[model samples]
Target chain A: MSILKIDGVSKRYANHTALDNVSFSIPAGCIFGLLGPNGAGKTSLIRIITQITGADEGEIYFRGERLKPDHIKEMGYLPEERGLYKKMKVGEQLLYLAQLKGLSKAEATARIKTWIDRFEIREWLGKNIEDLSKGMQQKVQFIATVLHEPSLIILDEPFSGFDPINANLIKDEILRLRDNGATIIFSTHRMESVEELCDHISLINRSKKVLDGPVREIKDAYKTDTFQIIGNGHLMITSPDFEVLEQHENHGVFRANVRILNQAKPNDLLRYLIDRVEVHSFVELVPSINDIFIRKVKETHHA
Target chain B: MRKIWLIIQREYLTRVRKKSFIIMTLLTPLLLAAFMILPGLLMTMSGDEETVMVLDESGLFEGKLEDKKDLKFVPIAGSLEQAKTLYQETDYTALLYIPKISIEDPKGITVYGKKNTSLQTQMRLENALEKEIENQRFMASGLDRETLDKIEANVKLNTINLSSEGEKDNNAMITSAAGVVAAIIIYFFIFLYGVQIMRGVIEEKTNRIVEVIISSVKPFQLMMGKIIGIAAVGLTQFLLWIVLSFVAVTAVSAAFGIDAAPTPMEQLEAGRVAAEGKSVDVINEEKGEATQAEADEFANTIQDVTQSFANLPLLLILGCFLFYFLGGYLLYGSLFGAIGAAVDNETDTQQFMMPITIPLVISFIMSYSVVLKNPDGPVAFWMSIIPFTSPIVMMVRVPFGVPAWELLLSMALLVLGFIFTTWLAARIYRVGILMYGKKINYKELSKWLFYRV
Candidate 1:
């Protein structure tokens, strides 16, 4: 069953439509990627779901019940414009925020201690938040947001500031949390991350959902029948069943790029290349998620 | 309720724990003491060793000034022109020129001196000439020296009563002192804490921390908690100030061989007698030959001033102060909170802040002159009863011994005012905290006040 369902949500700001008839759903306990380039309605949809901004058009449901103000307690949102009180101590600030999210002091402290130790920022407990590095502050904010153990987490560009190592750490943690039955709406333009983490993906363009489905399915639907044939030397093959799109020689080996005709299998193209020369390998070059995302956005713009 | 308490506790603990608050709490009394007593201390420390040359041309008389240990009188044997030259030649403190005084014109006496000459020097010279003429007349008359001495010791007939309970409550001085104290407390709390709320709001708004905080709590709750927390801190600091000031004044006076605290009866007697058209100078004198019976009568007529402080309708003063302080703060604090929420930055707050701050300033100014004159009169009564000015004007009136009905009325009105203002402010707060990019104006704020949640 879907955990969250947004139906016909629309948000207008003066002359501009922030989100136009945006609708999507998140399956229970899966990482759902909401991907779009800058100025897309990803943020608007996220805000509407979190109830930070009201939708102009339709209704949202959490666990089949209509979303209400108090339902926010069950969801964790880490907003894009990150901030913490500069003068407050890191530990105090985290505990306060955690308690606000409905955790008791002892529970918050215990959870905070575990996270702080995990982040190895135990010495930073007594220091003011302003004194911490930006990356460290972001980590603290992340810990505070998730410490209450909300069932659903909404993270907008959560890895924007972290270094490679920290990014992988957060990515791993996100996957672990999802594995532990927490459904997360991961919003970002980083398709590489979407490719790795998301089970289902939705791409928004210009305040509308342009394409959405299972990550592998969408990629497969947009795939072109292109393949590269590797052989001993450069060989030209002309057949009605297959077309040698290009040929290039690298060092002593020759590579032939080809596209199959309608209903022609890769084995047929491989057989055609084998008769012409010694064929080493035949590999189909499926488009990556990034290529598909860019192609879809461009197509939508042109259309 | 728990969230509100959490917010309030955080605000109070965080601010009160700051080094600035602790330092300010310690510094206020020392600064006040210095302001009040610095001039007197400086004067005494100067060791009065200045020489002055006197050229009394209008000297309706001469040799009338008594010599004192601090000042040496030098009667220069030279003309006005020669005295000017002598004055320039010597490092005289000042050259006094007492213009001629005609018997037909007693007010025509004038004294001139260099710019550097102190007013004390001029006053001393004038007293000398005036006394010499009086002494000459007394001697010329057939009056004996003993009779003249008795006449010189004569004092004005003054009666004083400290209690306001009597129908002929004659002690205006005690009332005046009460008015001053009341006005001061009102002035101190209103602005001291009102600005604190404004600045606190501005700080959170500017830092954009309000975004994170507002997400968890309602804007109204946040604002109420902040204002109340700061007020609690202000009250704590004020209580400390009163105690520390008392301790410090007592300690310093004790160290300097002075009576630190005046007896209640002594102060009341002084205030009451001063109210009855008597010079306090008479009370200051250590010795006088007034008859014991007359002295006893003089002392008995005046009620003690300590009765004013002690018998000060305790519940009344407390009720008035608390109501005025809380009401005034909440009423103004709501506006400040609205301003803080409406504006994206401090600079933007200035536009909205002026209108809210003006009434407070006016209340402060009114409490000083008009309110102090007659706390129960039409002007004071109306101003104190009004919501915006009541916090200050009412507190000012309390010291002057306000009637119970008026005090109760003012407190009720102030509380009602806070309720109305808080309701209005919360509406604006809801819209403003989330608003960004656009500059807010009074018209927009008014519109926000009427907007449905």
Candidate 2:
């Protein structure tokens, strides 16, 4: 079931269009990636979901109900520009943010204590945010975002400033939150992380949704039914069933990449290849999310 | 509402706990006390005790000079050169040489001091010689000393303002002084604390924390929270200053032994009584004495002066002060906050601040000249009614007893003004707070005001 459903949302600034007829949904208890190039209306859509600014011409439904001010309590947002009161003590600032998200003082204190311990940042509680290192401040901001335990969390560029170790830590925490039945919507330019973590994604280009689905399905839809074979094989015959895109011979082994035409299944291609060569290995190659993102965005741009 | 309260609490607590706030709150009263009392203390402490040798070579002015406070004159039985040498030898402050041929024109008489004497001392010496010469002329003219004294008696006027209600004695000096003081305090509070609200907004905006906070609360709530929080800080400081300055002034006055001096009002009343008693004595000369009646009349005048002070609407002034103080702060503070949001930095704020501050500056200047000179004049009356200048101008007219209808009208307009500005500011603020990196001008700001939330 989708936790958030944005229906035909649109936003416009004075001289420019920010979002245009954008529609997408994020399933519950899953990580959803919002992919787009710079200024492609991803931030605008996220702001609509968060209700920082109202949609110019659309509706957003949160948990099967029209989004209202009270629904903000159920959503957590970590904007791209990470900010906390620099002059405020870390623990106090976190508590304030948590309380603002509708947590009682006692609950906020307890939750903040748990988060500080989980993040191993107890030493930073008394220090002002200005004194913290950039990576450490990011960690605090992350903690502030999730401390309220919202069912849906939106993180914009969640790992931009993190070192590898801290990035891994945040990735683990995001997966952990997802596993605990919290839905996450994160926007990032990092395609590698999207492939590694996101279950579903909606790729937007120029304020329009170009591609969207589960990660596996999106890759499958973008695939060309190509297959790679490593065997003592030399397929010299031309047939309507397959086309050899590339072939190479090294030492005693033949390597060939072939694309199947005529809607042939993998088994049929294997059968055809087996008769022509002694097959040692057979595998189907699928496109990476990065390639799909680039190709789809380029396709939309050209269109 | 709860979120707004939280924001307000955070804003108020964080600022109130700052070291700068604490230092300013504690230091301002001492500075004000020093400004009000230190000079008088120093003047009294520097007692002027100096003697001058007088060479009366004209011989007609023999035994004419008299001794005065902190100043003494001694006849030198020698020439001018000898008097100068005596002045140099002794601790005399100066040598007063009266030439023998200069009785007809006293300009030739000179005071030769080691350094330039104070204007007060010089004036005193000149007054004494002028009085002696006048007396000599009067004697030569065969005029009685009594007639000369009578002609020299000063005339004092007692101005009483009469209204349909009754006759009210108006003390122009006290009322104007009080009006100016009230105006200054209002001006200081509004300017100091209004800028504080703007800086607070700028800090939040520049730090990029406003985005985070506004996610959970509306931009209007955030603005109101900050503006109200800073106003609370201003009032806290103002009240503390009043209490502390009162204590400080009292302590300083007691330490300097200045509390024993008669207040200006008491001195004025005493002068009137003295003038009255002189006339009464002249009238009762044939009937021997009228000391009992004179004493009774002097007591009655003192009672009347005290009653006038009692009749002043001090409570009304204080109540209006607080009302206008908060009203004015809210009106200006919201505008300042809006300006803070529209600009990326302090430099860009200059263009926006001029329109908001011009009225305040105008009112401050007018408070001194127009309002104080004529509290009931049309210029003062209208300024006190207009919302922009009313906070200060009305305060300048408050101690002079503004009419109930005018005060009510000004207050109604001020409340309406605050509401209007807050509505306008919140519109701009809601849009501007989220805007960044663009060089926003007045046109852009106006556009932001109409932008859909």
Best by TM-score: 2
lDDT of 2 at B177: 66
Candidate 2 on B1-453: residue-level lDDT in tens?
888889889888998899998998888888887876766666555545768788888876788887765668888888778778778888787788888754467668889988887676687788878978877877888886679756764444566777666877776766676667778888888888888878888888888888888888888999999998888787777788878877777677667765333444544555465645444343233222234454446445555565455555678877987898888888898999999988888888999999988999999998888888888999999999999999999988987878889999999999999999999999999888888898988888888878998
Which pairs clash in model 1? B58-B99, B58-B100, B268-B304, B268-B305
| Candidate 1 lDDT over residue span A106-173, tens digit each | 99999999998888989999999889888888888888778888789988888888888888888888
Segments of candidate 2 deviating more than 4 angstroms: A15-17, A228-242, A247-256, A261-283, A294-303, B53-69, B72-87, B95-112, B116-120, B127-152, B254-311, B365-382, B399-403
Chain B, model 2, TM-score against the native?
0.80
DockQ of model 2, rounded to 2 decimals:
0.71
Q: Write the per-residue lDDT of candidate 2 for residues A71-146, one digit (tens) a residue.
A: 9988889999888899999999999999999999999999998988898889999999999999999999999889
- The DockQ of each candidate is 0.34, 0.71
**Cα error of candidate 2 at position B253, Å:** 4.0
Top DockQ hit = 2
In TM-score terms, candidate 1 sits at 0.78
